[model samples]
Target: MDADHLLTRRTVLATATAGVAAGAFPQTSVARRLRREPFARAGTFASGVASGQPNQRGITLWTRLHDIGASERLGMEIARDPGFARVVHRETIRAAAVRDFTARTRVLTRRLDPGERYFYRFFTRTTQSPVGAFKTLRPPDSREPVRIGWFSCQRYEHGFFTPHAGLAAEEDLDLVVSLGDYLYEEDSPAKLAEREQSTGDPNGHVETLEQWRAKHRLYRSDASLQAMHAAHPVIAIWDDCEVEGNWAGEGPSSGPSPVGPRSVPFSVKQRNGFLTFFENMPQEPIGSERFRIYRRLRLGGLVDLFLLDTRKYRDPQPCEDATFEGDVPPCLDADRPGRKRVGPAQQRWLTAGLERAQATWKVLGNAQMMMALDIAPTRPVGYDSWDGYGAERRAILEQVRASGVENLVSIVGDVHTFFAGELHTTGRIGSPVVGTEFVGTSVSHDGIEVVGDEQQSALVTDRIVLSNPHLRYAKFGVRGYSVLEARPDELRVDFKGVRSVLAPTSETYLLKSFRVAAGTPRVRPA
Candidate 1:
């Protein structure tokens, strides 16, 4: 039978098994069917499904069974059409407790044809998941433009994922690029806003492997997140929050570093957590010789995307080496020996990628602000962003100018606000107007947490704009996602802000729009 028929039959069985009078049976029926027949369900397994890592050949499929030892294999199917009347290919995945019962099957099917839509579903003996649809990346020679929605940072307790639901309803986007903060490390009640409410274990810190996997499961439980997973493939990269907040490669910890090796907490467990993250995400880990965390994808020559990992190869934050803990030091001060930092390896990778890019528009899927801005300078230290990494930031901007890469746009998250600016270097070494950038606001992060009065966010945005001639726009108070569209002649970016994130029914409004031409490095109001 087809996938829908399979689910219908299973649901009927679930209802019957539960018995109409006993509501417990319906939920139990699903769990029972999943464990007894197909796989041995153990932990909290109803985390849902996601598909990503698309190519002309095939795409990646992901799901996790909660039980530590599922001790069973899963069957997955993909079709050229949704009905599955004509199945293209199928496979069985042997999942185990060692990997958190997570399974991934890189299916090779002829069903991936240009300009065609396809449907996919994962199945076991008694249970079949809802269907997901994906399309192949159009060949570089094709003339039609492909559209995409990009976003980042969703703290579950702060608000509902209403914006994600809106994105799922959008009829046009071919994919979504998530630039990290997929899950937060601190799940404590105190860390979250007092007004916010979460059902389970608020502020339950996730320092172990199991906690991380469970957190990913918790996020997947949101209906809006599940719906988005079923709609389109996603290109993603993790930032600080995915791991420990502001964690670096090396650290002194709470006190001074020991002269000898000290026991690091759950290093293996944290690595496993990263693996679980990979298992659940749609994108496959790019396994190259150097094990680089960078990948490039093209959409019919209309757009080229470079997604990078800024967290992995970076120098530990300067404060990591400090002996004191009352307060962290400022990263912007040139004199501060301990400042926020980025390593050399990542800098080299990004510069090389920009030099090699060949597309109508080159987009950088980054995690935090690349443009320098002084936020709250009066206090003592100046900043924490690219301003702190002055040397590295200049080098990257110089490469963009020297490589002659036109129409560059960097989409970033973190800092929970919307920002638009141009890369400005001190000298004539770089392009006068190096490129354009659009920083998407958070999905449901700390809402309106600007410093001082609500006016502070605007004041900071205005001063940065006035100080830098190349910088174009900045809005901090709103929260939501961004729609990035490009044609051969012009590219448009729209910042869609939700009216409120605290509720399930938040409304989206177009807060701003900016465009850049194929030859122009600067963006202008459209």
Candidate 2:
């Protein structure tokens, strides 16, 4: 029988068994344990294991049991050694069919030591999960240097995940940050196709809850992505593609609806997308606000990472245009005072966090580009990004400047190109620089070349750099990730590019490096 049929059969059998037990024993604790014991030996850990949301005392670990008949209890272990020789903690966790057989748990304070490296794994009676490792955050007063690897925009059908493999091999990385676009909701057009056809993957959009779950499963099946998650703890946030392209969280479509006008409502689709995302990712469980993802993480006294949600609480894209081209001119609606990108509440939270943060470096884990980019003489592009909410952007920068926050830097993605620039309050050519922004290239998504050929793409990039004086460097048509090293006196970023993602494996090299000295808001070649 097919997998779906098998699942249906198992569900029916489990339900029948549960009803009989409840009628016989009045649903006591002992009866509940007995009901779950039979399925403890039924499944395999196909999705591997992951750890994330690292704090000084603990971290969250995740795993999924595939091909299971019912909810099962599993053994979890955390150790200081990869060989499991120094086991420190052990517990029992459950993988429930209600959560698609996925199990997530947190090992928090009083159980683990701070600023230490630990390994973890999950196991059933017959099968064992691969061991994953994570490093806990240092003490708040410590001045340790932190290394982070960040990337975004990995459409499964676009190319291979060689960048993930590269990141997994980095021994010095403390954690990996996924800015957004972990997976695409739908396949792109044919002309941009890059993956091999022999893979036999489905080609269309996903709308239903089951389809979204299956999409997450397909993406998790990637060995390289699994390896990266296993190697380091991740801090992740979602962008537009996580649900639908150019989707607004509040109401209707901001630009164009990927789902037909009469199909499922935007709210339902958003819930499905958020549910699957939480089920698959290694993060905290959803709470009162079901879709809340914006949060903050602190690494010692050196870095404060604020991961933002640019999609969930924002106004729709202004001018009703989401096209990825620069042909559209600047619209007056984009400059309206009330237009919001991060929404009012989130803006207040971010500004308050910035004002009170004691870390030496304030890093914004932004999903989209923050620096203004002008494609033509007077036509600003990327209205879907910070450019669409000029008033809010200026207000935030003005707060940063007036409050005298030092060493502010934003690491962003979703543009599929590498950019290092200075951010100004008004986004003018010679405006006072308030911070530095580093936009990393995508892992495998098509860059500017998707719109034009190599020469034409280069010409457009050149024009953008020349038009924006605050921009120190820009590179078009590259596929790779970036690494940021934070120290007490300076912050450094290195853009690493892959030779090709069409192949299963490719060589990676450093494209460029830039740095900003403490208290200086300008970016310079390192």
- The top-ranked prediction according to TM-score is 2
> Across residues 1-526, which tens digit of lDDT does each residue of candidate 1 receive?
8776775455334433332334333476654554443432223336666777777767888776554444565656677777776767665554556666777777666656865667887665456677888777777777677788888888887777778887877776767989888877565343335324332233345655666777777778777778887888887887767766655543322224221231236355347547767767866667663334468887777778888776665555443333112355553443243333446656676678778767788888888777655433322122234544456666677777888877788888876777777766531224466777788888888743435775776675675555544457777667788888888898888888888876777777889998878887676888
Residue 438, model 1, lDDT: 82
Clashing pairs in 2: none
Q: State each candidate's clash count.
A: 9, 0
lDDT digits (tens) for residues 1-526 of candidate 2 = 8764563344435433543454544478976664556436657888888999999888989999998877777767788898766778766677878789899988886668778999988766556788899999888898888999999999777888778888888876878999999988776543224542221124356766877887788778878889999999998999988888877766655666655643466677678888989888889743577778999999988999999999888888888854437366568776689888898988998999999999999999999877887776445765787878888888998998899898999999998999998888866556678899999999888886645576776776788888777789889878999999999999999999989888767888889999999999889899
Question: Model 2: residues >4 Å from true position, as ranges?
Answer: 1-39, 189-203, 261-263, 285-287, 322-326, 450-453
Question: Lowest-scoring 10 consecutive residues by lDDT in candidate 1?
Answer: 375-384
Assess the local accuracy of residue 48 in candidate 2 as a C-alpha lDDT between 0 and 100.
85
Where in model 1 is the C-alpha error above 4 Å? 1-45, 66-69, 188-204, 252-269, 288-292, 318-345, 376-384, 426-431, 451-469
> RMSD of each candidate?
7.8, 6.2
CA RMSD (A), model 1 = 7.8
lDDT value, candidate 2, whole model: 0.81
